[model samples]
Target chain A: MPPDTTTVAPQSVAPSGAPASGRPADDLRTLESGLDALQAVPSTEKGSVRRILEGVLPPVLLLAGLVAVWQLYVVIARPRPDLVPGPLDVLGALGTAWADGRLQLAVLTSLERGGVGFLIAVAIGTPLGLLLAEWRPLRLALGPLLSGLQVLPSVAWVPAAIIWFGLSDATVYFVVLMGAVPSIANGLVSGIDQVPPQLRRVGTVLGAGRIQLATLVVLPAALPGYFSGLKQGWAFSWRSLMAAEIIAMGGTIGFGLGSMLQQSRELADLGSVLATILLILGVGILVELAVFAPIERRLLRRRGLTPGGIR
Target chain B: MSAAPAVLPAIRITALGKRFGADGPLVLDDVTLSIQPGEFVCLLGASGCGKSTLLNIIAGLDAPSTGTVTVASGSAAVMFQDAALFPWLTAGRNVELALKLRGVPRDKRRGKALELLDVVNLADAASKRPHELSGGMRQRVALARSLAQDRKVLLMDEPFAALDAITRDLLHEELERVWRETGRTIVFVTHNVREAARLGQRVLLMSSRPGRIANEWRLADDGPRRIESPEVSRLSIEITEQLRREIRRNAA
Candidate 1:
């Protein structure tokens, strides 16, 4: 990668004309200047520790304030410990669960089920959505059903799923599939619908076959929508798995967060119940931050579509 | 290569007509023209003229309502007014997609894309996405992508219309150089009289409202034509006057 400065010459690549003829070799000059004007300088904005601190501080302070308020309410109300656990009691219960490794086991079990179920939903939903998008008659027939399924809460599927499969992993998976597939499929459909007509024409004129157009052009163009669908699908899958665990009890299925929540309720361990609720909320928040947010930010940044980048 | 057979017309439009729906008005009616190999022909008309429609049909993006259109050699590639470079792809990747579709080997595509970008004087910008580039740069990438198709005919639909005057002038020179180098048959559609005069060896003027070929001019002169040249300005003025008359006739 050495510069090889000794061999370099300062000559223009554009064709030169005789000075007497007077075309003046301005074409190359014009091109060079025009490019100099058009080529954007790469962004130099740096993410310093100060900026990171600024971003994190508000959320941290808000959570602390909420906890303080909750503790104050408990102190004033002085409810019986068994009836309503204070924040400290819930934390103590969480610490004990963590020490015994029950908390870890429940978290792992629930996350594994949610991950597998959401992946399956994506596998089925993406192509279904693409098919629905491309074919007019199919979209007309089935589009409304997909939207309706999204509106129906994931909990509603638990009874039907239990009846179909009889308190097994199959029942849990069925519930997850019913809950998630519609959202992913519908997101993809809307994504496909939003594809600019000009881009499609560009694909056609570039000699892409129908399949090529769909896979290469339309699919990549729809990434934003697909990612949004994936996020929603994950949310639904988690909700559906919890619903299945809560309703279809005494299963041979492993201990999950939902079952733990139900057990704590039945035993009337209010502190454990609060701890379980926190764990569920924590897992959802963790996935949103670690998995979805970074990918979405990168996608938008690469396209220069971030609102901050516009001006 | 020197012994290669005589070159044929690159594009032929015969008795072509186009309409939208069954009840829609005719957009183009009985238009016929032949463009020679390596020729630069400009299609010029007013706003409602079906010049863009004709280019679309020539590019095979839309079908003619009647009659036949033939391309003499390889397929025609088109450059639209907007750059239409996929926002998801980098500049080099945008050009490489066309090459990929044309069945270029995967390993060769990257180098070939860089080379094409160099032809448009954008080798340094290969990694930039469409949005990172300004209007002119994006259009340059679009042009490179069209060239990667390696077609005999290049159909441009007002490709420079969206650019500012300075950028448009620069592009005119760049395009002229490319046409000279590649010897591709170019049918450039534009409403700009000076642009048509500067670039085209022949200009075909069409009348609007059931667009039809109303006049033709052949600039078989001896030298390179610049847009600001007296000769080019004179020709543009002549064409503009005739174009105005056609519009008035339609209005009347």
Candidate 2:
């Protein structure tokens, strides 16, 4: 096709006082600012209070709605206290646990176990993912198997883990690793696969060695996928730890949120059961908010992938 | 340009041929060409002409199926039709990466990258990510990144093909200015006849399906040539006619 050389004059977009190419300095400055203004994103200048409210209000309303529904069900059905617990009953149980410091202790133990398990998963999975991504024969043989493992729920691994490691922390860790490694590895592989060929070409042409290219170019490109994998891995770790704690039935392992849940269920203390479930949910959300969300937001915002970008 | 110091041409290709596989038809065949040092050469051809393939071989990014390409400078940088700037990187950091690869020290890279960005009229945009920049601005950053290589030869495969007409025009002027300033040998592959007429000191028109150089135009005038100039328009027409004839022959 004949290249269209004439479409519209650039003069409209050119900066005011843009020179007609005689003075080099003037022309450059005009072009620079003009280009900037042309591509400028709208200022994300919402008031801080408004921004906070926008972020927090919906979730708060959703929680309130959920509590209202729970309360309504309690009032309507008049379920025995031994069965479904009302929101206030659950809250009272939570407050009692908090006063005794068991709530904090249980949460910390679960979080620590989840954190350690996830770290181990990352340490193992990252290299495995890189290897699978780079080596065709190995990938072809094992890629499908890894993906299959990811789909299999962490609870399924608990029986095997208990048999192998007994009623110890190792059993919990084993289950967590089994649940998480595949996900993290798969994430890395997909990310590596998606690194655009042109970007690699650009890196090669720019004189980056294979190691440098992989580290500087490919790794950064794959960050979104890696971060996603990490998030999923954390979820897996948390789920696996809970399953192990609930099933193992050992007193020495200490009271994690999962152990507390089992104790509440056995005693028919539905209020404590509901409170334990809420605590588990709350901890998961807290970790996501404090650890993962900020990093993800920063990554996306800096790359201009976020809605408003860094504001 | 800089007083032609060396006898060697910037690029030399001899009896070049390319095929996808053993049984595949030849994409390029028996192409021989020489590009002088500090010259602006445009390879102008239609779709399936192997212009990009030829450029790739010269760039050391792809191996030719037959014959050879020898670049005197050894090092060359390429700019693609897409800006292909690392979206994860800021505009300056993209250029800085090129400089860093070339072994520019920690402190020097930032200064050098800023200078290169300035040349592309993007100094103020150094901290902006690729996704934040307009297509034109992204391309200018890509250009700056290419320039950061400090290489004597640049291979561009339709670098401005995706830009709007006005942006392309403005870039053409900026590119011409940079070319004049740097004195680097440039091989720009484009389907645009007017673009070839406007920028290239010499234009090579290639035929497709076993691509070969069919015609050549050397702009003899010493005066500056704009894309809209009568001389450029006349040359563009001449070349377009020749290209049309090549396409028609294929149709027949």
Candidate 3:
């Protein structure tokens, strides 16, 4: 990323002009205050106008380009109407699904499964991460196993989960957990690892006990890492939920895009299958925009980790 | 900012010695010092002179290899170069955190934190996060947070080295004043001789490798002694001569 070259020259935040400046530390206090004033505000205002335009214009052009290419491809392929539904046709399917109420149900079911499983994964992963990162003996014994599990594909868990839980929501949840727990734990571990030692020493000098260390020092220090893990864990949950839905094949499962595709495949309706896949993609992007991106932006904003070093 | 008044000697380190490995170099060799209750003392030396190690010992953050360190009152808090402020905390909350750990009441903490920030002259930006602060601002907040310990001693390790010249100069004055007003003992370490001279009531100079106190000076009764002044230059030359001999001996 190009460093945001924006400048925001804030007059010192001390509206009182300066602290009682005659004393030694008081002058230091005034200077410190001035610097703090600079800190509390960010520099984004400088290039925000240009940035807003830059951000908006290019994505619009990219979408237009994508649509144009799709149109051209359709014109060239010219498949039979039932075989090749255009983007409009898939959108129409989306509309019908919504009108039929099944879309809401399908989405709700998938989300419920992903959400519950992801939460459980985080709960398990956080402590597991703490152990993996802090407890040398435990980490030594389990670290490799945890790492190996993350790389082990979610699909590999489906067969085992089917055998263990046998086709209910439990099966889907089990698969999701299996897929995500490792990543969550590992994310936390890495977060803990990245925290500078100096911060930890601060905790010690502050007389932090074990719980205090974890809550105040370790956890906060690992936040950016934890958030990143959560993002990845959610991805895993959604992906694993889809996999389990497709393969488990035994539930009175709702018409989630995953199941919808399975049904469409069984009936050999390629257009519906394409529509279902597109629906899933759209939902993922929408959730990312509405949920995760906002969170990431929020975390970044609080830290004034803005593009410009405002002060 | 050097107005922090001294009530008592905040810290006294006598014949303090440290040696890391059995067969290796001595880190701090027979160092003796006393920090007046509100004095700003900077330990000026290159990387391995045990400047930080000595501060660590005084802060009671690390045990000394030998000798005794006695503090007049509460534990000394350390301010690291990176601000070392908890990122999870808002700037106000970070200060409050120190109070909380020190057993300051919950209700009292917020008010006290504001007061401390006001003392540091950063009362307005309480809610800002560390990431929101610039490099210099973060260190200032770090200073505030350390001060929140209510301890009479504050040990800083090259805390302003990372900041720019303008910010560094401003902080030096800030530190000076904080020490004076709060009457807290401050033991700051920096490689910068001027900074040591600028802030310290007395600067303790050290030679490298097997670090030893090469020289010391009392800046009291001096009228804004410039680093280039005859007195400052004489001391620097003497210390540098000692440093040169040590380096050459090590090379040999």
Candidate 4:
């Protein structure tokens, strides 16, 4: 970016105690100056493969090792092969189920229920949270209830949802809503609560009234909290959907992976049940990796909230 | 929009009294100050004194308990010790928020923001986030944002206290230059005696807790005086001794 520092005056204040060999955050002013001379290149685009290697490699290796040891223990204990299914047997069962198209449909159905429930949770929970945050009297009256609602298991809501909405998609959605919405709303409420009073004053002094302050300063600062809530809400929604599927009997809300696990259990097929469980766990991880993790990384990076030289 | 700007002193504090609460002791007591247009006044004191409290009152961020702080027209813009640059925005855009608030049209805000960024010699760092920049650079961006308000008065609360000596000194020069160029009345608050000496045209030194103006010094020497200038040194020592006496009296 710079061939010579002879005549060109450096602009902007240098970091404290920085020896600018032009290299920032290190010893050497000339290098720091060289670094300053060197224009900061835009960050490289993070590829899916690179992100996967970054995210999946460590956890995947650990989980694989755990499973391998567990499988070995089972093989040693129950040589009858009834209690122990080797790794290949589970993979082969997964293949066979996929070949039969049951696996895809079940996975797709679960995704749909989870996705719709999550979207609804965000829509309903965000506004409710904002309202609860803005209105002190209402928040005082209902805030404890909201917190209590989050702690109550989603499984607990299934019976009540079934009683109200019957055996239908609506019933499953209702259970998911009950399970997920409180966390999302509370996250926003707490996020709004934690917004610095100084920022609010800045907003107010700049001609912003109550609504604008909430929309501009209050909402953005609350984003870190909002994202965390969304992550937790999705976890709750997925779990709630599975619980709802298990409890509902009469009307077929369609077959999902949870139902397949139930079917495999009734048929006494341990290998198939175990395979279904792996698929559920794999999907859970993949969605977080594919969707939420990237966003979280980006937000953290923008704030310098993430440490450097960790790669 | 059509009314001509009011020509009164940029900020007028009449019989100002502020307390933490109704039952609490007065933090600032019956203080009356009138900041004329384009005047640069430094409120100097030790930590926990009411210098910051006074600046806040002038900015209208906090209300005075028993008095009115009236700005002739347009609200006062503030620069805090922390950059307070809203980490979410780029350096330029942080300044742009002020323009947006002042009712500058959306189309024109970017240009004005850039122009102000140029004023603080930070045009190169316009796109950088607050966290991306170093401490001194962050404060420069903050100074740019404060300038963008285009108000008659700018209230700064120890804006450079967190920075290092070199950066702080550099900013003092930049501030003096900006103060002259902008011709806006400035009420700068700081606990550092040298800093008060360096920047202030008239330095008002406050005593300890339940802070009040113990003495006011009128510096004959002009802008960017050395920290060790005879007049500046003499006044600073005199003020420091008085401040020390005040603190020691309380302790005894």
Candidate 5:
């Protein structure tokens, strides 16, 4: 059994041996500062030059090796120039296209279509994703359908779009939307799903209303996933546009990289065909590195999600 | 300090009870209590005693199945065990978010946030992200954020339970100082007997199995207290014995 009295009488106002007021506070300050300094996260960021080299070197080396192999095959096989063009022939084709400004025009035309299509996809997909995420019954009904649409090749839509729109810009845009919208919407859905329940509770405790919660807490938290989705959406839009341009050629359609490749094929210009493929691949790689890569790196770095020594 | 006779209780609960689902087991039963303004009370119990459930009810995060809880101040702020700081915001901005939600003007928020961070002795760590700060610093930033809510009542659910002993001890001092400085009504829930005896003016021990308030102790002395002090240890030992008895009774 314990003592009957619940209250303990005051023994003393201040203990005889206790540390003085200002001293303990100062000591605590020192101790805490020491702990903070000791446990601080070490900056592992490499120099700018080193980081660039690390990112760019491996791909460059791989491309060089591929070119070497192509030259060796040309030397050994001795095939017809029009059938399997050598690396130099492809370079010459690129040079001719550049000198005549055809390369620039083709690249710009394709890029403009891709950019407009992706912007439209963002406008459509963001709301659709937010709606799907918010309404449970809608999500249950449409979630699987969205995922299925993402897997269905946007290229498969080319013939239907051509039949519907009759070889115009509208046909290209329809194909691009069909390809990009699902991925963007699905990305947002998963991002919203992955937000920690704890964060929602925090927002509520801090007096966030429904709109405030969605705009401030939920949307920002969903950004990383949404961004990746946008990247994938852009890729799909570009691919779908290329497919539309290649198949639905002639009749008020501007010539793009895809049409250029098709033209080279018709003329038996294998070198130009290979050159156009290289140009397409180059555009994809350039967008990924110049636009998407830097943004993703900054996002992950701000959240401390990146592993050490990689920045 | 004692509340004036004319002042109302900071919090009043009447016949509070809670259960999860339609046929779910009762988690809390008949938990009626009143806390005076500026009183520092500890809700001490074993794990699964539904202490957290009672706190949630008072905080208005969970609804009580069979009673009403009234807070005279009309609002309360809570500090959770995990700190729960957003990783994207810096420590200062985390506090500023609460202020912004409270309708503070944009131009004034930064100054107020820095002031709150200063209250927790974290003025210099305002720009550091949650991930950059140590565990103790994160909790301090959380404390600063909760304080920025500027409510008269503060509810804490084992806020220091996850931290190391040395840090927990230091935080106890910081909390006591803050409590004294701000004079807010605090209802702190914890399983640690010594922690209760050290920080609380009154310790309410709750029993398990449809949790109810089983015993209470009042330590009326006004002075600095240490967890390892003989007085604290003596009271902790007494509470532990009563707690063991409650457990044994539940087992039967």
Candidate 6:
């Protein structure tokens, strides 16, 4: 590779006072601007309304179709109401729960636990990830174990958590941490690994010290990977919390969606159980659309990883 | 040129040698050179000629296995083949990072960054991200960031090799303008004969497999030269022939 050099030609007296170079200064500027215009990617983002419609309409239509299918199945086969509830029955059950405020309470309880547990996992995982990333020996010792933890079904931890913490918020949190921490830590490790050697070299050349390089360069570079880790961690946390809530329900633990579903199962009320399942799915979708999607889109757009502003 | 006070050489290398390990083959051997203040010197060589290693030694990124590198200014700023800008940062903020590292206060950093961007004729691109800019434009922003270091010497390692021919030509003009304006000593490493002939005031050719300076050319400061100019082409041909001979010698 040839090194690129920039130089200023010593001013020379050309006939008619024209600069003695490739082109006149004005012409060069025009050429440069023209080049930039031609090569630069144009913004391809659609209007906000269109983007929203595009995002929302398909899922909305799909959900409606799903309900229609369930209703049709009920109308055709005519299954008993208790054995397999129709879509309307599920909706009625959801309405009854909403009317009695049970739905709101269950949602709030589950969401609060999920949020707190995820935050704690992040707090713990971030430093652990950094430590593992920075220390080769430690990573060698523990990296495979961390990855293995991510694949282990978090539900498997519920019985152990219940035995250890005895049917309290501690058990729920313990399960959630076990599920989420490995994912967040793994995300950070991979993110750090992905930071280009060139960028780090650039930081060193710019006079960044060890700490500055890690904080300012390496960490920021690792963000996309770290962010994906957070998304995965949130999923794991929510899933683990639900599992723990269903299995270890008693003493200081208010009714969550998981508990409500378990109660409906015990009563053999298929409608309420179906309603609870829908609510859990809805909350997961809401968080993804409201929080993670927007952040990921912005990250990708800024890095030009998204082509034509479309992911 | 106006008469000026005597100045120390911007860079001096003494018997510099580099090898990967004790038993490894030498990458650079017995390399010695001195560059005057405000000089534009190009290290021209083939792929494995250790020109980049020699540069790394001067930039202090790599230690010499033997001998010494004395840079008068105590610091040098470097640019690479890729712009190597932080992707998360806008072009201006990328430059500002260098200024910030130099301890420029937050209040003053933006203004200084913009000033350097203006030097590279990229002031309008300050807010654009590196990926959003064209290859040529990205390199210009990189130039701005290097300039933001406020160092007396700028080391470039094939900064425009990835650009198109027309863009590379334009950047050559831009770089010449900057070098003249900033009066900074520059050590540019390149494998391209014409690029060396077109840019550097002095061109030093390095031989590969225990790289050593094989020959040198001091191009006369004739009125603005272009890559296509007869003088540059003639010199490039001469240098290319010498470079080929050096390669053949290694084979023999």
Which regions of candidate 6 deviate over 4 angstroms?
A: A1-27, A307-311, B1-6
- Best prediction by TM-score: 6
Instruction: Name the top DockQ candidate.
Output: 2
Computed on C-alpha atoms, the DockQ of candidate 5 is 0.40
TM-score against native, each model: 0.90, 0.93, 0.84, 0.88, 0.93, 0.94
Ten-residue segment with the worst summed lDDT in candidate 6 chain A?
A5-14
Q: DockQ for all models, in order?
A: 0.33, 0.45, 0.39, 0.23, 0.40, 0.42
Total backbone collisions for each predicted model:
0, 0, 23, 16, 0, 9
- lDDT, candidate 5, A1-311, per-residue tens: 56432322222122223353433666666766666687677877778899988877887899899999999999998989888899999999999999999999999999999999999999999999999999999999999999999999999998888888887889899999999999999999998999998898889999999999998899988988898899899999989988888988998788899999899989989999999999999999889878988888888777878833432
Which run of 10 residues does model 3 chain B get worst, by summed lDDT? B221-230
lDDT tens digits, residues A1-311, model 4? Answer: 22222121122122344322222222222332344344344555577688668866887799889888978877677654546677777888899999999999999999999999999999999999989998999999999999999999988988888888777888899999999999999988887888788778777766676776777777987888788889899999988888887677558588888788888888887789889999888889888868987788777677656723223
For model 3, residues B98-190, the per-residue Cα lDDT tens digits are: 899889989999999998887666777788777777787778788888888877778888898877766776666567657756777778888
Residue ranges of candidate 2 with Cα displaced over 4 Å: A1-25, A28-32, A45-49, A307-311, B1-6
In lDDT terms, how accurate is model 4? 0.78
DockQ of candidate model 4: 0.23
Stretches of candidate 4 exceeding 4 Å from the true structure: A1-52, A63-78, A307-311, B1-7, B221-223
Over the true interface residues, superposed, what is the Cα RMSD of model 3? Answer: 11.0
Deviation in angstroms for A204 in model 1? Answer: 2.4
Q: lDDT at A5 for candidate 1?
A: 19
* Candidate 3: share of reference interface contacts reproduced: 0.52
Give Cα-based local distance difference scores for all models: 0.85, 0.86, 0.75, 0.78, 0.88, 0.88
How much is the lDDT of residue A288 in candidate 5?
82
- Output the worst ten-in-a-row residue range by lDDT, candidate 5 chain A: A7-16
By DockQ, the candidates rank as 2, 6, 5, 3, 1, 4
Itemize residue pairs with steric clashes in candidate 6. A3-B158, A3-B190, A6-B175, A6-B176, A7-B175, A7-B176, A7-B177, A8-B176, A8-B177
TM-score of chain A of each: 0.85, 0.87, 0.80, 0.80, 0.90, 0.90
Q: Over the stretch B1-252, how does candidate 1's per-residue lDDT look in tens digits? A: 467357667898899999999879999999999889989999999987899999989888789999889998757999999998999999999999999999999999999999999988889889988888888888989999999999989999999888776677667878987898898999999988778888899999999989999999999846566665667766776787788789888766
